[model samples]
Target: MKKVAIQGGGGSNHEIAAKAYFETDNIATVECNSFEELFSTLKEDHSIYGIIAIENTLVGSILQNYTLLKDSGMVIIGEYKLRIKHQLLALPGERLEDIREVHSHPMALAQCSDFFKQYPHIKMISRDDTALSGKWIRDNQLKGMAAIAPALAAEKYNLDIIAKDIETNKRNFTRFLIISHKEKIALEDILTQQPINKSSLVFALPHAEGSLSKVLSILAFYNINLSKIQSLPVVGSEWEYLFYIDLVFEDYKRYQQSLNAIRPLTRNLKSLGEYHVGKRSFDTVSNDNKPLSEQKTF
Candidate 1:
């Protein structure tokens, strides 16, 4: 049996992906309430792998998860994308007009702000997970209270989907990364056989004129492509910043050459390791599709 640890609050999205990816009957799923709990769960259960949400199309990058990845010892072995469909669920027979209060995760609530605006009289309450809110509503049997979650959640908890596709954006997607205590030897071997498509690094440059520009120019000198760059505030140092960069190159040799060239331009440089961008296969599913009644819950 393969034991996998997953972020539990948001919904069964992470758990569903894990089950689908592994496709094994001998799988044990462990739920973590928060990022902290997820990491700790990974540490305590060395046999389990961690599946985490890294970025969302509507809400932008999950910055905190990036930081956690940078600081933690976990390795990013794989990734999968899941389309999010937010549903407004309430007790059976409850109408939209009967709902006076809505609850869901902060991100879910924010994503569906436009939907909630129609009912200005209703109070919006933020909870940890969309499914959790649905379960709470079901348990309490609150007639005027509803939850913004997945249609599967409403079905699992015996709630009614009063509204569907409530997210502000129609094309909502979330990228999830699979982390494991045991690094994937097969992935590394495959990456080494070919060229590394993406490389990630973290560095701190001296606060000086053109320091940042010089670092960027070094990559351009080697003709490396910069895919993404984000800056995070340095802890304990007021106003100081650390830049995290993702670069794509034609081959590993060129990537190494670029790294060697840029090393001298920055004060502190750390290679957060490199891995080929895995195939994004989940994007084929249409985001507009609603969950079927037989949807499985974690």
Candidate 2:
């Protein structure tokens, strides 16, 4: 069986991907308690695949995961976008009025802040995983206690959904990336090709007026389109910023040339990674191919 190491407890978002990507009978799910555990497992297990939550519509970017991916050598093999549905789950026969404390992961609690505000008397406790929180509340049989987690988690833990779609924003989505220790193949290898809609790079610009303009001009010169630009505080530097950019390039060669041209204008330039422009989707396996259970490692 192919073992996939996923972030958070067994019933978290990562398991959703595992179910979508690999056959259940041939897949082994490894639960990681924290980001640290996830990274360590990735380093130790060469054959293991990982699904990490990169960003969410309601909660914003997962900055820590971004840093982890930036520093790690693992290649992003695929991505999956899961629609987040937050549920207020509690122990059996527990009513909303009976709930005094609600526990969940920080992000989950944040996303449901508005809902929680309605019950000002209820105390909010942040835990590691939303699903794990639900499990804890269930296992402990804590009356007047609930958790914010996905419906799958509620089903797995046999908790009742006291409230549904409790997020402040109705359009909640979380983008996850599937990473592998195996080397990434050239872009040409993927058959369902899409236009290179987004290009990401990290760079430090020279501290001078028009320096930023000059860097941007390189993209303009090549007719490269930029989608988003975010400036993050540069570590150990006071008032200086490291710029992260996302661009839409017509072609890879043009993107490369644009990057090459900007090299001299910036103090430092590095391509973090490149992915095709599109919403997340899963890979399809041929029916005739051997199941993961029958496959042998070299």
Candidate 3:
């Protein structure tokens, strides 16, 4: 059984994505109140695995998580993209109008901003985790308080959906990274199971003219599709930045060649992961983001 450390409580999106990714395995989740705690848990026990939200299509990147993951020295073995649908959950007998305050992760609250704008009377309070907020209201039996969290959270905590799909955009999605201690993964089996088509990388470059452009040109020559690139300033380094990038390609050998071709130009270039692009094959997560069956597999 895989022991996965997830951010937020049982029914949070992290947990949902975990189950969906590891669809056929008997895995256990260690609920963490924060991403920091999630990494700490993994560091303390290298046997445990982890899944974390890297970016949300609705709210953009979870910038802090990128830094944490970089510093954590954890390996990104896989990735999952979750379709997020936020719901306003409250006590069984409560109605939307009866709620005086809504609580959730800042991102969750922000995603549902338009819905809350319709209920200006309800105060929005930020919490560390989305599902945890609902769990707290249920545990405390708090009346007139609700949480904007996932639909699975309602089922987990026995909360009522005061409002369903409350997010401002119906087309919201969040991408999560599957991380593990290097020894915990059998890289051969993972890459061999499917075509290695995508990669995540982190690196820094010398502050030289056209240094970034040179790297991009090499990748282009090798036909590597630069799926995404994010830059964060290096602390105490004058005008230097760490680039976090995602690359996609049809040929694994060509991908490696691309990396090698540009490796000399980049400083401290680290390959975070090389895996399959998340798509229909991992669609076990239903419309409500619930597991289709109790079967264990990732």
TM-score top scorer: 3
Q: Clashes per prediction? A: 0, 0, 5
Which ranges in model 1 have alpha carbons more than 4 Å from their true place? 16-27, 182-196, 235-239, 279-298
TM-score of each: 0.80, 0.80, 0.89
In Å, residue 86's CA in model 1 sits off its true spot by 1.1
lDDT of every model, 2 decimals? 0.75, 0.74, 0.83
Worst 10 residues of 3 by lDDT: 289-298
lDDT by residue (tens digit), candidate 1, 1-298: 7778877643467776676556554567787888888988887766778888888877778888887887887766656667777899999999999999999888888999998788899999988787888988888888899999877678778899999788888677887777776444343453455345666688887667888899888888887877668777677774377887877776678779888998987756876556555433344346534432122221
Clashing pairs in 3: 23-297, 24-296, 24-297, 25-296, 25-297
Highest lDDT against the true fold, candidate: 3
Predicted candidate 3 versus true structure: per-residue lDDT over 174-204, tens digit per residue: 8889898776667435657777778888889
How do the residues 61-155 of candidate 2 rate in per-residue lDDT, one tens digit apiece?
77788778777776565555666768999987889999999999898888899998889999999898988899998888889999998887888
Whose lDDT is higher: candidate 1's or candidate 3's?
3
Question: Candidate 3, which segments miss by more than 4 Å at Cα?
Answer: 24-26, 280-298
